[model samples]
Target: MASNVQVLADSWIHLLLNLLGYGTIIIPGYFLIKYIKNSQYIERAGNGIFSRIILTCVYGNTYDKIVEDTIQAQKPRKERSSFSDCSQLIFCFLGLQVSYLTWGVLQEKIMTEEYTDLSGSIARFKDSQFLVFVNRILAFLLAGTYLMVTRQSRHKAPLYKYSYCSFSNIMSSWCQYEALKYVSFPTQVLAKASKIIPTMIMGKIVSGKKYEYYEYLTAVLISMGMTLFLLTSSETHKQSAAATTVSGVIILIGYMAFDSFTSNWQGELFTQYKMSSVQMMCGVNLFSCLFTSVSLLQQGTYFTSIEFMFRYPRFFWDCIILSICSASGQLFIYYTISCFGPVVFVIIMTIRQGLAILLSCIIYMHPLTLTQVVGVLVVFGAIFLRIYCSHRIKQINARRAAGIDSAKV
Candidate 1:
């Protein structure tokens, strides 16, 4: 059985390499279509042979779909209790879960593998930094290709326009991986779950906007839950608890601080530029790839990592899978936020994180202390409470508005 699984894995690696090598033939054709789409005489020249072929093969119904979707988004959409909406929600939920789980599993597998006997170069290159670098580059390439194919560029600003957000995002991702070495995955997640607190604080500082009472309460609950979880975690790892906590706290502090700004920055960009999710993703990742590339070179691991990858093809395969999952996960997140409101999006993500913790414990056989369970429950309760409070507020406001209208009548 083990041999069969190994063979299957090897087959996949080979297939991925072949696909990567041969995928460039369509590049020229893609750029040609993009140029034609951007040209003012496109309609008049539609009868030309080259234009006809490009329109048939690439544009066809896609052109109409993009225009219709953009127009629909601009208008006030009427909410409908429809089967299609339900199906879309279900589909997005499943896709997000699978993509996220797959990325996490692949990362853990790569990091925890038997690298002790490997050469120093191979060991060093297998760190979270390398993984993140490769993932960002892949995502950038994919996003660029998407733009070329669609002939769309919503934000024409320089790449540096997104540099700060991209840098913070990449750093947050790196810190998540770094913290994994000191704390268990569940512990790392619990630490990240406290991001709501810092995010609220940062949002207020950045935008000078006050949050609702429920938002503040929710943030407080999450902070308390994380504190409880950390306290219990120390008790479990009594011997090394001090060192682990110090290191984990440092890493997680960086992660949370950077993460708190990322959402706000992205929101600012969207509001200012009216950029689509793909445009935002492409811009951020393109700059992130540049930043990561510089870091890898500065650390002098770029060549060594390539050498290591050549020696162990499986490592390369895992990185490729990680990249694909990261890209897909981002798109799924954007799609969910666009289709559903942010509240539904947050609820869906909360569920995803809960499942991730559960699955990590099951697969890794990590002990979830009773206190930790309570912490999880507390965090989840806060989320549910926020949802209930929001609903109640909306109801009260609606009734008050109706009363005012009746008085005016």
Candidate 2:
């Protein structure tokens, strides 16, 4: 029914689509689990397996740093704590990973019900999505209020800090997910992949990070990888090329902007709130659930989502798993950023993209072409370029320090 070129393109495009969809769900997730392992604060929340060891270390540093800087109250990093704290990190990481493993099924469930949630609410409230969105906001507001009251002895303005970080999540997810509804899978991946550029840009602009020429070179290589995949891919008549590209770009930009701001924002949380990592996580999700709910309800999507969720309980459960995994992952992500900073985190995230591309073809039972393989390799090369540069800088710094010490001697 189709020409060889068209069929080849279709098959290849399908492969890309799986990459985009799965990658979108997976990359951020791995970092989150990794983040939890790295966070001393979360590990210290209780007496358990991981909490006793890792939590003590994470929080010990956390407490020492925040106390020294903010309050001029000094505490040693190795001070012994009666409570064991590492189990929280263990549970958090395990819970997040389990969720990620089940994400495909859960996401499928959410996809079916999510739109109805927004559209259904429209009849009762002219801005029904907005109303439910408000309720979801109320949920997080409740968390913020409770934390502020309960933790009042610590510091003021956590509400403000959490508000900024959480608020960014609401905006970023809304824009990116909304745009995702209209685009193809591969388009989404490339667009999302392009985020390395804007993130690099924002990191330079807002975070005062510099980019090397290799980083630029890496970007070009990744772009080529994507372009090859795209060229070998077929188009959906659902939209024009321009429209699709624009939407993908918007998604990429939104992801980049919010993620950059949020990552930096967390450093403040780790430094200032000094709250347990789990507590910070609960705080963000608590807010996110509220915000997303209100936005959907005001648009009448809330009631619709509910109707479908109830009608398809099984499907809804899937979304529940996905949402929870996603939420927990967010917590891990905060820890990762706090532990390794944005650059390394991005490298890990991008590497996951290549894995996603590889797995999606197999998992989805799609055939990959030689060109598609080439494209994937090219993208990987790009990721390596950025990661190598980022890694090299750390090594260089250590060498420089050694040199300085020798000179001083």
Candidate 3:
């Protein structure tokens, strides 16, 4: 048995497996994007309760299904809307709270564990301990189960849908998970701002969407806000010493880029494939699980310590909670991006960031400065600016159509 195991664990074999895993994380994005462009629903809803083996079946007539019908007629789309399904909003709120809290809390744990960012995160994966092994298993199980259940209840087979949207969703998640292992919570928020650039570029290329002058101005303002916050609030600033904050900032930037890619790609998906948020999410998570599991195996032989949760129940419990939090936050983030445009969604996220920052100040009591306050305000302003630009553009298009109608008349 041991010799057979060794045979299977050849470096070449393991390398192939690992690459496949990493590929799983991003490759599906192509399909996801294709789904977006196809302009229709591909996945179905799961049985109200999710199962590990099932793939959520998307409504058959997804392309033909009216958006308002899903939002109004049956299975709940977003609970937050004032529509009849508003009650689902309560769970949705709890879901959002759990998601943010988990991201914030796990982020703190990562720091306590002395991780700096994704580039460095691979190191932690190298150190094999029973507890972390258990964590890998649990994370895989929880996240994977959710993915499968979501898929069974929500999606069609890979054969039926566009691959670009699915793949983009997978890449977006892969980057975020990898980043979470490295950066600080607040820095992550700052990093989230980076998505704007990618969104703009993708929008122009894929969606044929042109940016207005104000949009460019808003991007500049967003950059300035980030710089001010970095300069004013960095630990180096407080100590009056030069130091490297580069790692922290880089992790966030990575997160921001992938996140914006997720959103910007959505517009293309909507224009091209017309997939629902849930459908895309199902694809992303399914791919994420496959890759995460493969990555865990390559990190070390995990089966030996799989039962550690039984030995250190407390640690196991903590990790479980953390994983749950992580999962919830991820779900909320994806949902938010899908429901609200990326700009509006991030604007809502800033609320969570502000709360986290305030608590960080109270807990560690980090020194607050006027510049820091201004920085936060600047982010908010940029978010509002994006929303305004989007709204105004919509109105202009509406009027353009009305004018065309008059011309035809």
Global lDDT of each candidate: 0.65, 0.54, 0.52
Candidate 1: C-alpha lDDT: 0.65
The clash count for each model shown is: 0, 52, 48
Off by over 4 Å in 1: 1-94, 114-127, 151-153, 156-158, 177-190, 226-251, 335-354, 360-373, 396-409
Ranking by lDDT: 1, 2, 3
- Looking at model 3, report the run of 10 residues with the lowest lDDT sum: 122-131
Candidate 1 clashing pairs, residues 3+ apart or interchain: none
lDDT of 3 at 163: 38
lDDT of 1 by residue, 331-377 (tens): 77666655553334544655565566666677778888898788778
Instruction: State which candidate has the highest TM-score.
Output: 1
lDDT string for model 3 (183-290, tens) is 554455445544556666666766577768887777767756765665555453332232224543453455555566666665554444445544554455544455
Q: Which residue runs of candidate 3 sit more than 4 Å off their true CA positions?
A: 1-98, 110-193, 205-208, 234-259, 346-355, 362-367, 403-409
TM-score of 2: 0.58
Tell me the TM-score of each prediction against the true structure. 0.65, 0.58, 0.58
Q: Write the per-residue lDDT of candidate 2 for residues 1-409, one digit (tens) a residue.
A: 2563464455346435433543443466456546866763563467687664444322334455555465545545663321232344345445444444465445544444433343344121122223224334444454466666675344322332355677675556555555565456656656655655666666666556766788777866776676566555433122333335454555556666887676666655665555555456656665456445544444456677666556655545554554555554555666656554555455445544444455666877767778878988887777656656766786797799999999999
Whole-model alpha-carbon lDDT for candidate 2: 0.54
- How many clashing residue pairs, candidate 3? 48
Looking at candidate 1, what is the lDDT of residue 104?
Answer: 76
